[model samples]
Target: MYHYDNYDQTLVDERVAQFKGQTERFLAGELTEEQFRPLRLMNGLYIQRHAPMLRVAIPYGLLSSRQLRMLAQIARRYDQGYGHFTTRQNIQYNWPKLEEVPEILEQLATVEMHAIQTSGNCIRNTTSDHLAGVAQDELEDPRPYCEIIRQWSTLHPEFAFLPRKFKIAVSGAQKDRAATQVHDIGLQLVKGDDGETGFEVLVGGGLGRTPIIGVMIRPFLEKRHLLSYLEAILRVYNRYGRRDNKYKARIKILVKELGQDQFAERVEAEWAMIRDQLLLDQAEINRVQAFFQPHPYAELPAEDAILAAHKQCDAAFAAWFRHNSVAHKVPGYRVAFVSLKPLGIAPGDMTDRQMDAVADLAERYSFGEIRVTHTQNLVLADVRQSDLYELWQALTALDLATPNIGTASDIISCPGLDFCSLANATSIPIANGIQQIFDSLDYLYDLGDLRINISGCMNGCGHHTVGHIGILGVDKKGEEWYQITLGGSSANQASLGERLGPAIAKEDVIHAMEAIFQTYREQRLDDEAFLETVRRVGIEPFQERVYGDH
Candidate 1:
């Protein structure tokens, strides 16, 4: 994790103080709601359906155990006793008092954390692969680049107020776990033909009301010009992106209207003007890269005898190990996912106690660090294979050991009408209903690598556009209806899902989903994943099964 320098600390401290004053003024009637809207939003505070929700940025989804404990304390003392981990890999306090939000910001600053750029029409948090340095397939760790962007974008005067919120994601791994293709700016680290590292840049990809996979703006961007090129793109968007309509303001919309070639040409022209001025030297790249050097991993056997024995003895532990643990770059180590999608709880809601316990577990087992995934789970990225059993036990005690990492039960969902005022229907209940129906582990494993993402509305906060099976909530007259999409993915070959058919009534959503699953099971070839089957046969079969007799 990148620790803050004095400059970083000072900047955050000053911002906290400034926001404290702004919040006080709002409460004292010095600023009306209209006046305070942008200010509060800039600080990641939102007036939700029932109370004020404060989203705290977990930059690139990285957290130290100390920071995690502080977040637990904030959740315990300020809001309700839990916080919701979001698709952006941030945490949200849904019940925080408006008056105490400034205090929360102050507390977050003490741990090198802040809420700045987390909301409003500005460059949001720069996210990356949660398994960054530890992934076996990675060409290089992307976090250094992510951190560089974070520092550059944070309150940059030039981009302080864009037409709409801009999101950037970087993926250095062969697999695109960071969902880079669906971001405003997606940078995939690639080795150039000359054997030098560079980027494959994608632009105009986003999910909201209009979903589109990003077009490859640049097949290869030199490392030295990363910042300058990003600045150029932002400049182009800021100057030409729609300001008249919020819905049409995203960079994706601009790219769409102008066409990919024209958009790229505009960015290239802008880059030619400023690229030389912002060119990064090797030293600057090295300076940022120094923070992400490999962890001091011990030399251990490829297989843990005790762990193997424990797996043989405990069926539950074996299930968790099979599903929740991923291979690490180093031998004898694993990246363990702490599943937040239990049977009844909201998908990513972690109680304060669970947070504190996970912090403790991270300190004891994974070098005191935690990584939040875009799928709304936590990652202990350096757990030794020898210690897997004990860690699994501890996580089980905290109800965090759900053996359904990529299964249908491991749903990705947004805080829909239950919390978000922009939502038309409730997403949490739909997610819960799906989880309950797919409760059997054997059935889930049979379904194989199926993803179910839900969003209350078209804001696409749940990333429903990328799920293997996407459930979108809609308002029909006075009734709640759900729309389904199939074959959407944010992985290596990113693509937006296609709508299955007419919206099903909310009461029939579970049945429709069941039919979809059944269709997959019956239609799939040997060991083919749900996504593979969807692409092979198309959504017509599943759609017919779901809506055939309706």
Candidate 2:
């Protein structure tokens, strides 16, 4: 994890003092609600349906065990006994008092964390693969660049208060776990012919009311020019991106209206003027890279007999090993994913006890490091293979070992109408409903590698547009309804899902989803994945199966 320097601490401390004053003024009736709106938003505080929701940024989803403990303490102290981990790799406290938020920010600053840029139309958190350095198939570690971007964009005066919120993702792996293709700027770190690294820059990709995959603006941007190129792109968007309507304010719309060619040309023209001024030198890059150098690892055998014996002895342990663990770059290590999607509990909700338990596990087994994933899960990125059984036992005791990381049961869902004022229906309940319907671990494992995502509204907070099965909440004639889509993905070959059919009544959503799955079971070839079957047979079969009775 990147430690905060003196300058970083000073900036966060000053911001906390500023917000404390602002909050006191608002409570004392010195600042009107309208006047306090932007200020509160800039601080990542939202007036939710029930109470003030505070979003705390977890930069690049990396957290030290100390930070995790701090979050647990915050959850127990300021708000409820739990917090919700979000798809953007951030965390939300839905019941914090508006006045106590400054204290919360102050607590976060102690651990080198903050809520800045988590909301309010500024450059949001720069996210990367949860297993960035540890993944077996990565081209290079991308977090150094992600940190650079975080430093450059944090409180950038020129880009603050843009027409709409902006998101950026960087992928170091060929598998694209970061969902780079669906961000405002998607950066793929790749090597050039000279054996030096650069980025494949894609711009204009986003999801919401209107979803579009990013277009490749430059085939390869040299490492030195990454920040300069990004500056140019933002400059062009700030100049010409939509401001008249919030719905049309995203860079995707700008790219759409101007056409990719015109957009590229304009960015190039802007780059010519300011590229030299903003270039990041090699020394700066090396400075950031040093913060993430590999930890001291011990020599161990590639395979452990005890691990193999444990897998043979316990079926539950075997299931967890198969579903939740991935290969690590090191010979004796495995990256273990902790699933938050257990049945009946809200997906991504973590109790203070659970948070503290995870922190303990990270400290004991993963070099005191933890990572948050885009799927609202956590990662023990450098766990030794020999300690798998012990860690699994600890996690299972905490109700965190669901073993459904990529299964249908591992759902990505947003806090919908229950907490969010923008939501049309309750997302957590719908997610629970689906989980209940698919309760059998055997069944979920059989239905391998399926992604199910639900969003409360069209804002696509859950990234529903890219799920293998996507559900969006809708309002119809004073009742809650749901619209389903199929074939969407956020992987290397990303694509938007097509709507399955007309929106279904909320109560019948589970049945409709079951019908679609049944159709797939009957039509798919042997060993065919859900997405493969969808692409091979198209959405027509599922659509007919879901809506034909109506």
Candidate 3:
């Protein structure tokens, strides 16, 4: 993880103090609600349904044991006893008091964390592969590039107030676990024909009221020009992106209106002007890269005898190992995912006690490091194989040892009507209902690799656009209705899901999903995953089963 230098520390401290003053003024009536809107938003505070929601950034999803403990303390003291991990690799406190938010930000700053750029129409947190450095298939770690962008975009004067919020994701892995294609700008690190590392840049992709897969605007952008090219793109977006309507203000809308070829040309023109001014040097890249060097891994055999024996002896440990653990680049090491999606709990919600326990586990087993996944889960990226059984035992005590990683039960959901004022329907109850309906773990494993993502509204905060089984809540008359989509994904070949006929009533959602599952079981080929079957069979059969007519 990248530790803050003096400059970083100073900037964060100053921002916290400034926000504290702003918050006090707003409360004291020096600034009206209208006047305080942007100021509060810039600091990641939002006036939600019942109380304020404060989003705290976990830059590139990296956290130290001390930082995790700080977050736990904040959750315990300022808001409810739990916090929600979001799809953007951040955490949200849904019940924080408006007056105490400044204190929360101050506490966060002590741990090299902040809420800046987490909300409003500015560059948001830059996210990358959660398993960055240790992934077996990644060409190189993308966190360095993400950190570079974080430094440049944080409180940048020119981009401080863009037309809409801009999101950027970078992935150096062969598999796109970061959902890069759905971001405003997606950068895939790749080597060119000349063997120089560069980025394959994609532009204009986003999910909200509209969903679009990004177009590859630049096949290869040199490493030295990464910052310049990004600046050029932002410049073009800031100039041409619509401000007349909030819905139309995003860069995706600009790219759509201008056409891909024209947008690319405009960005190139802007780049030519500022490329020299903003070109990053080798020294700067090296400086950032130094922070992400490999941890001191012990030399071990390819297989651990003790771990193998435990797996053979303990059925419960074996189940968790099979699902939660992933192969690491290093021998005898594993990257283990801790599932926050239990049967009745909110998909991403973790209690203060659980957070403290996870911090302890990270310190004991994973070199005091933790990474938050885009799927609203946590990861111990460098867990030794020998420590698997003990780690699993501790996680079980905390209710974090759910053996459903990619299965249907491992759902991704957003805080819909329960917390978010923007939501048309409640997402947590729907998610919980679905999980109850499909409670059989054996059945889930039999069905295989299904991603069910539910969003309370069209903001796609839950990433419903890319789930294998995508559900979006809608308002029909005075009641809540649910819409379903099939065959979406955010992996190596990302695609938007196809809608599955008309919306079903809120009560009928579980039944409809069950019908879809029944259809899949009947129609699937040998050992076909849910996504594979959807693509092969198309959406018609599932639609017919769920709706029973047209």
Clashing pairs for model 3 are none
lDDT of 2 at 89: 92
CA lDDT, candidate 2, residue 485: 95
lDDT of 3 by residue, 298-384 (tens): 998889999999999999899999999999999989999999998899999999999999999999999999999998999999999
- Cα RMSD of all models vs. native, in order, equals 0.8, 0.8, 1.0
Per-residue C-alpha lDDT of model 2 across residues 134-181, encoded as one tens digit per residue: 888899999999999999999999999888999999999889999998
lDDT of each: 0.94, 0.93, 0.93
Clashing pairs in 1: none
Identify the leading candidate in terms of lDDT: 1
- Clashing residue pair totals per candidate (backbone < 3 A): 0, 0, 0
